[model samples]
Target: MMFKSQRFFKSLQLLIVASLLILPLLISEEGLNSIISTKAVFKYSIFCFIFLSIHFLHRYLLFPKLYARRKTILYFTSLLFILAALIFTRPFDRLMFELRPKPNQVDAPRREPPHSTENRPPMGNERRSGPKIDVLSVFLFLIIITIEVIIETNKQLSLTTQRAISAEAQKTEAELSFLKAQVNPHFLFNTLNNIYTLAIIKDENTAPSIMKLSNIMRYITDEAGNEFVSLRNEVDCIEDFIALHKLRLGKKTTLNYEVKGFLDAEKKIAPLILMAFVENVFKYGISNHSSNKLIIKLAIEDNILNLLCQNSIYPDKKDTERSGIGLTNTKKRLDYIYPNKHILEINDDDKLFTVKLTIHL
Candidate 1:
């Protein structure tokens, strides 16, 4: 949706600019046709074509290679040479417009008596011929150059603004990653401590717990560094996290994990984006009683990721120290990366904590 909107606005901007540029041509054609002959209008169009060719070349090629690179001497020199070439091509322009009288006619005998009603050919001096500089062409050349410079300036400004926005987004993402980095070690230490406790007690689950921690750490080290990863990977990570917690809490906790609809590995989402809520469920929802319950549902339908997490909370068992930090960082990352492409809702009452997130892939 964000990309579509950006593309639409760019297309609209180009359409508006094209319309504005063509408006003058339409006006000139109509006004010139009314004031001058059709042949004169044709000459005007050719004149415009020449000016456009020069404008495009200078704007796209010469300016970028010379003027934009601060080669002022070469740039000015080339522009002067172009102007001289146009001035020297006046004879060719006149020939193209069929404005030149025949050379033979300049020295030929008169076609009719001067007093007769018949039309007479123009005398040699009456027709201007050969390399006559056109002031109008020069005027139009200057106008085109000025207009192109303004357009180029606007284009440069737009590019600069886009670059600045991209840089700021990268900076924000870096900050988010740093915050997320802090959470990784904290979670890892807690999981490791659990494994150590199991090892000290000589529990059979200790070896498997170490293996699970290793797998989870691999995912964290590899996928967490990226801005996005496959949704399948995220799901697998969540399952591993749930399994790890199950080993720790055992029969004291009940975790209901359900995945509905087809999962596409091709679809991607931000890494560690959904895990904070999953981690929160185990952190606060785990209790040494049969009544403790954690429900997690991940559904994919029509390229949308719907994640729903609900966990039972007791008044005296809350861990408020790390409660909001992960959620805060996750929200900031969502705003930075997904922008308008996602929806997140959190509901917390006395008995339960619920989080629902919808992401458009």
Candidate 2:
């Protein structure tokens, strides 16, 4: 379809050019009769054919194969050769006129009164053969070349931009996949460790904890690889994660997890984006010998989602090396997925670690 449309437009352009070239002859004293005459028609046709031939040759062949490929000398040489050819061929119509039979003219020469060279009008043949190179024709040829060059340059630029954009998109996708892969294993390892501790202690909650892990795993397996998941599903997964942690919580630990706003079914979020913070709360903020308080709050209003997670810090329980990886990956994911659409602030003081995140849906 596109090729057909392009061909149609090209044909229309050629027709318009041919008409413009022939317009002068059509508007002369003899008007349409002069253009329809055999000599006039033949001369105009030859000119149009040569002009169009050069136009296409330069546009498709010379530009693409030589000039565009940086063959500067050869390309310019080709242009000069074409110009020379046009200059040499300028008398082709006169040659044809002299060769053709003219039955109306007698073979014997007739004497005519000679006029002063300064005042006498020039002969028609003299006017036709004035210059080997027509300045206007040269100018028109330059215009054609300029227009083609501009069009081809623009086309090349557009094609280059599209390729660059495609490459960037693929890179972003690969990075996101790598980050998600890192997150899944880290989360599973921690969850399994908690379940392992429960099993070692022979706690009755072990089986139920395993069941909760099963649900969390199901969510991960089904939705973790997706770019976005429903807010409801994400909330359910977070709740399940918290429940899994609650099974092994120390008596001295107090966790306050709250969701203050209604969750919209249509709203969606990056899967597991909030889990890293929640996981850290259980990992480093709880203690069996000392009282520990952990608070997590999530609110949604006016198409914006906000999260606040605050936990009591334990100096002796800190694991610096492994602790930052999850948060680092999550931060990168947030930057990739939300960019300026989200704001994340983390504050770590002597006794408390606080995280605040705001996202525009």
Candidate 3:
């Protein structure tokens, strides 16, 4: 489609040039008659053929092979050689002179003063008049070269821009993949630790916890690699995560997990985005000696989704700098996928830690 449009534009430009070349001859009756003559027709045909051949030769061969390859001296030298050849050939000189109408003869001959021998200018009929075909040919050649140079320069710039954009996109994808790889293993290690605790105690729910781990792993394997997942599926994963942690919660520890608003299957979110905060709650907020409380709420209204996780901080189970890998990667993922579309706020006080996240879906 692009090639066809370019060809059409080139044809239109050539037609306009041809029309301008012949316009002066079309103005007078005798000039019009000269145009229809067999000799004049043959001359114009040859002129047009030569003009088109030069145009195509420069566009496809000369410019691409020499000028585009940085052979500047050679390219201009070739153009100058072509210009000299056209000027010496003088192809349109006779054709233009023949098409010009001859001046009308006077009915009575002008009578010179009998005694006046003063020199007088020659009559219009005796004067030599013709188009400056060499000058015109040089001007036309310069115009063609100028146009080709501008076009090729613009084409190279556009190709460079496209390549830059492609490289940036690939870089972004690779970074996101690396971040996700870091997150998945970190998540698996924590879940396996929980299962190990249950197995040591020989709790009745140990087998069920293992089964839950299997389901969670299956979801991660199947859908976590995708850029977005159904919001409904993500919510289900969060519920399973909470259930698995409940088995290991101390009697004094309290967890209130609630979901408000309708969850549409059509709505989607970045996979594993919310899990990091949830995992942190279990890691650093649980205690058997101290009374601990964890509150998690997710609400959706209109196209906005909000998550709030507030937990009582236990000094003995408090997270260290090295244990923040999941949250760090999650923050990076949000910047990559959501950019300015999401807001996250974390507040840590002596007694409590709170996380608030809002996303524009």
Q: lDDT of all the models against the reference? A: 0.70, 0.73, 0.75
Query: How well does model 1 score by local distance difference test?
Result: 0.70
Residues 1-361 of candidate 3 have per-residue lDDT tens digits of 4455567656755664566456436644576686676777787777666666777888788888999999999988998888888888765554555555544476675678997645543344554444445666666667666766766676666666776686568647654654455344544676688889878988788898888878777878788878899999999888988887776677898889999999999999988888878878877787778888999999999789999998887666664543432676678778777879999999997688999999998
Over 226-330, each residue of candidate 1 has an lDDT whose tens digit, in order, gives 878988888888888877777666666777899998768888888888888888787778767547878998899988888999998776666556632277777
Worst 10 residues of 3 by lDDT: 121-130
Model 1: how far is 49 from its true place, Å? 39
Candidate 2: tens digits of C-alpha lDDT, residues 1-361: 4345446545655664565455445445555555555666777677677777877898679988998899989999998898787666763444334333333455674445685355343555565434556555665566666766766666566667776786578657655655555444545676789889878999888898888788777887788779899998889888988887676677788888999788999999988888878877876788787998999999999789999999987778766555322786678778778979999999988689999999997
Q: In model 2, how large is the Cα lDDT of residue 315?
A: 72
Ranking by TM-score: 1, 2, 3
Q: Model 1: how far is 311 from its true place, Å?
A: 1.8
Question: Positional deviation of 186 in candidate 1, in angstroms?
Answer: 4.7
| RMSD values, in order shown | 13.6, 14.0, 15.3
Candidates' TM-scores? 0.51, 0.50, 0.49
Identify the superior model by TM-score, candidate 1 or candidate 3: 1
User: Clashing pairs in model 2?
Assistant: none
